[model samples]
Target: MTLNRRNFLGAGAAVAASLSAPMVLGAGKPRVVVIGGGAGGATAARYIAKGSKGAIDVTLVEPSRTYYTCFFSNLYIGGFRELSSIAHSYGKLASDYGINVVHDWAIGIDRDAKTVSLAGGAKLPYDRLVLSPGIDFVDGAVPGWDVSSQNKMPHAYKAGSQTELLKAQVEAMPEGGTFAMVAPPNPFRCPPGPYERVSMIAHVLKEKNPTAKIIVADPKPKFSKMGLFQEGWANHYDGMIDWIGQDFGGDVVEVNADEMTVSIDGEVTKVDACNVIPAMKAGKICEMASITEGNWAPVIGHTMQSRIDENIHVLGDACAQGDMPKSGFSANSQAKVAAMAIRGALTGSKVFPAKFSNTCWSLIDTDDGVKVGATYEATDEKIAKVDGFISQTGESGDLRKQTFEESVGWYAGITSDMFG
Candidate 1:
């Protein structure tokens, strides 16, 4: 299915009523606690509250009061958007939907007791818990780089101050200086994100520092939309990007934040600005809950329920669900499925088969856009891809513009769906 604003919203709407389980009996309204306020959590919180019609008590625990979306932060870096444009508030979710939006870090989870411990010294009890805490870097994933070094070699993957810092560093680079990127391995959040960042940075340097160069050391030999991104780089910023893939020692890399240098295959190069996106794992809270298998939490695609614990559902970049890319659209899609299941489990609302879809849009340069996406269905085994689409290499300029326009509309629609 082609993912537009209309279909995207329609896809999430509940379908024909099916038999529901007996309504969960509890002392008060069945409590639902959602951790993390990104694409998945926010959407799940809103959907549950709205569909339950106050039958469920929903409390969302997120550390930040203002959430900055990772989806369009690249455009912000490229000057296509302002920083404020990507920042969102939970006020609407609180006021309109009546979700208890708690601005506190989720420090621990007691699955046996069905409670979430917050850093602010509060214990939130839940009948069902939604964990959508997004991704966290694996310790020692990149040699010589750690969270402590983030200030010097900003990962900027979290999309807030780090993003701003990386942009400032790029703007502060000397004329003809070199910018380097240590791209993450596969199964990371947003498969095309690193390449898009490269494009956005290239867009910035093309205007301010035309002579500036970019070097990307990628662990993978190829990436999502590789052909299209390569085409765009050649057309818009030719001779400006040097991509070193695994065959070319891109996998054998290390960084020295103190020295501001990158070492690939024993060859060291001083860099004026460096963006190091490391290997990722499920957010720490998943591990704390003891639900992770290796780096991610495994889930049943039908309900997004944890394989280890049925009462807990994992969503977004944190889950080891099959086929779907870890993206904002993917998370939002999964959230609707999870929300519907939760509603059925808690309030005896009619449930339907889980249908998921995702579209990832990348802006190559001004008015030059490309995308790839697919529709998915939950099977007994995993979430399997049904069909998919991608932008053609030689497509007309007008179609590319249309694709970009579609992405802009999606951004507006999804955010509203999430926060409101």
Candidate 2:
């Protein structure tokens, strides 16, 4: 039988149970502080509070009141989903699970005293800290691109207003105009995100302005799900997209936001809209906490505990876990493992072996969907991939449509899991 949303969720029940086992606290309640309210942080916060049954005090620090997921924002750009559909509120996490939701910036970390300093002049003490702060762009990763220039050439990588801005820019483009994208380097958040964004942009253009063209200047030789994306692009929107790899001088690129032009290996081309997805590093809070070794924080595979500091566990795109792509699904899976281990350490709950899984689905046209996924197990050294699968080229249209529907179900399920 074909996989549908209902059965898929039923199958996940056992997995969820293994990760979230309630604990009975003995005496002094342990305090857990979670920074960042995105995929990993929010899930970690929810599991800890729900599993501990008020035995552990869970406080979540996030700057944004409404969290816009970066996962399906591309679908919004393609006119497949509403902006309100992808935006989530923290009220559910607070009211339903009794998590202490603090909407403030975490400015400093006092590791010696085990306290986190807030921008509002309050210090939160944590017995165990879970940091899932996500990603921040590296300075000068793309020359002539910076935070100040984001308004002119929106990255739209973080979702929210940036996503809105990018969509508006694409819609306002003149007929037969150019949409240029500067893809990021390796080990970035959402391995297939940039290509998916390209597909969405192409979808929009195919409807609004058929003559428009997409130019992708990628730094890497190949990208995630390359064969599927290329095949879909050919079959769905042929001759509308041009993907330039590193061998063709796509690696070395410079942009002039003021001039509305990009220089790729000394060749210049003017564009109506541009998206510069710069290289990413662990969020600044990780650096502030002194947990980051280089661009990412190193964590033990079984528990996601920071190698730099045992009391702190890093999750999601910010962590340097082996073989896991920096997708929201990976973060959410890792969050469950960390939550289980934290409960075990603090409340003396039973700790189970870490098992993780992730599936990334991208829509080419309306029902033309492609995916890649894997199941993983934690070894002593790294999170190792045990089994994997990908959508084969030239699959039946019915399978692709089912895959698309499955993705829709997954979005609903995972968002509910994370926010609630």
Candidate 3:
């Protein structure tokens, strides 16, 4: 199907013009169901509820009351920001935005009937559905690593209890104990995230336990912000960080959580702490809804609508957007495009193609930051990047602090756009 996305959700009278004040129509107005309330789903719900006015009945099914964005979560883990600052409620979207936010999980979707079945066993029928369920880990992809073992080895990728548990483990480890990080392969959420997290943890180790060491076992040979991370480690930790890339027999295949060791190249390295960020796939809702094939759900990019089923739209880290990394910033930007597409799909209006942009920042030390950003456009089939995307090249006093300032400003703005 042909798709388009317009960033212009017109201001002022646009709402008044879209439909009369509190317009009423059972058939003409569509029942739109949005699943998940992370970066993508929440933004989609707010915009669709605002722009549609009383024209559409919008209900968002999300499991959590508050969202902690993965975009800047590392800052919180590193002690640079408070958890309260990272956590946000859906009060804005629920109260001011005029959307019904349901506290529940979407267990199944009937594409033929165009309805969503919740875990509570209620059948909520819909004219169209928007799903941005984020991601779920594939079972048994990593040998000796299963859901049961995850409690001992926290992935901390989802950002919440697991994150807290992981952080507490790192904090409680014996002084000079080894902190091992099992990095996932590429095409995972936040490509630079694992390394940046390691950098921050190393920072923690340096001030508290100078002899503490960090061992990162990677399945990939190289990573994002390599030079900057190396430089920071050299200056700050005295090379206390040891990275074993896949080239250096560091391709981890299995783990023994009870033993606190991970196997790489037929060898096991015991450690006091382990943060194994395994591979990811579309969230459970997608699997229940049958919208996913393997790790991702396929979608038409211009509109962020599902390619398999036109009435359903998918966005964020869960959707198969080839060009963008699975970052919260990417999800937030894509939500705008998805919202417009949902509006058009409901009203039968002409859809406009979309362009997207995202910037991800990682802090290495106090007042020191690194960033990677990109520009993108949506084609009829997939999301692809435009030229000129760049990353922080080197460590300097000015550039580092400047990026920190920018990171702070970004949190302020995006949170405002999302929850403010």
Candidate 4:
């Protein structure tokens, strides 16, 4: 399925249904506890509540009151968008859908008891638990770098204050200074995210400090939309970006946050700004619940249920579902599937075959955008990709502009779908 504005809107509409008669399992309504109020959790909560029509009780646990989307944070870094533009609230999900929105950190999970322990000393009991807590950086994945050094070398991957800090650091760079980026390896959140950040940083530097240089040391030999990003870099910001992949010792890297320096291939270079995106793992809650297999929770594609425990469903970047990249669109797609399954299980609603789709859009410069996406279906083993498409190199300017516009529309539509 080609994912356009019409299809996006149609998908959102499809998730909406009339009230269904729910099975009375106990004294109260079927309870669903969803952790992480980002794309997957928010969408799942909204879909379940809307589809069930008071049949299911949904409680969403998230730490932040204002959720900043990682999808468009790069554009905020490039000054194309304001900081407020990416920030979202759970107001709609609560006011419109009647979801019990709890602002707190989920510290522990007792899978045997089907309860989640919050940092505020509250316990949430659930008939079904949805874990969509997103990614957490692997400790020691990047040598000499950790959360403590985030002020000096901001990861900005979580898209909040770190994003503001990184943008401030970039704008504060001295003339002719170097900006360094340590990109993470594969199976991380948003495959094209780090590269898109580079483009946004380059875009900023080209306008403010033209002589400033950008260096990216990536452990991966190749990245998503490589050809398109390379072409855009050459066309828009020539001689401003240097990308060193694994072949060039980019894999052998370390950082000295105190010295504001990076060591790639044993060569040290001082940098004014550094964005250290370390290797990622499933959010800590998955491990706490003992559902993780080597950093991620394995899930059945048909229902997004944890392989270890069927009562728990894992979505988004935390799950090891096959084929789909770790992206907001992928998570949103998975959430609907999980929502349908949960509704079916709890309310005896009709269940349909699972279908998924994702489209990742990247902005190279003003009005210059590209995208890659695919359609997927749930097989017995995995969420297998059916077909895919990408923006070709040397595309016409009009098409690129159209693609960027399409992405803007998607952001609006998806946010509405998730939060409402």
Per-residue lDDT tens digits for candidate 4, residues 235-349, read 9999999999999999999999999999999999999999999999999999999999998999999999999999999999999999999999999999999999999998899
TM-score of 4: 0.94
Per-residue lDDT tens digits of candidate 2, residues 354-385?
99999999988899888999999998888999
Q: Weakest 10 consecutive residues, lDDT, candidate 3?
A: 1-10
lDDT of each structure?
A: 0.93, 0.92, 0.80, 0.93
TM-score for candidate 3:
0.91
Task: Compose the digit string of candidate 1's lDDT tens values, residues 316-378.
Answer: 999999999999999999999999999998778999999999999999998898999999999
TM-score of each: 0.94, 0.93, 0.91, 0.94
Candidate 3: stretches off by over 4 Å: 1-27, 348-350
Residue 388 shift from truth in candidate 4, angstroms: 0.5
Model 2 scores a C-alpha lDDT of: 0.92
lDDT of 4: 0.93
Candidate 3, residue 331: lDDT: 88
TM-score of 2: 0.93
Worst 10 residues of 4 by lDDT: 18-27
Cα distance off (Å), candidate 1, residue 63: 0.4
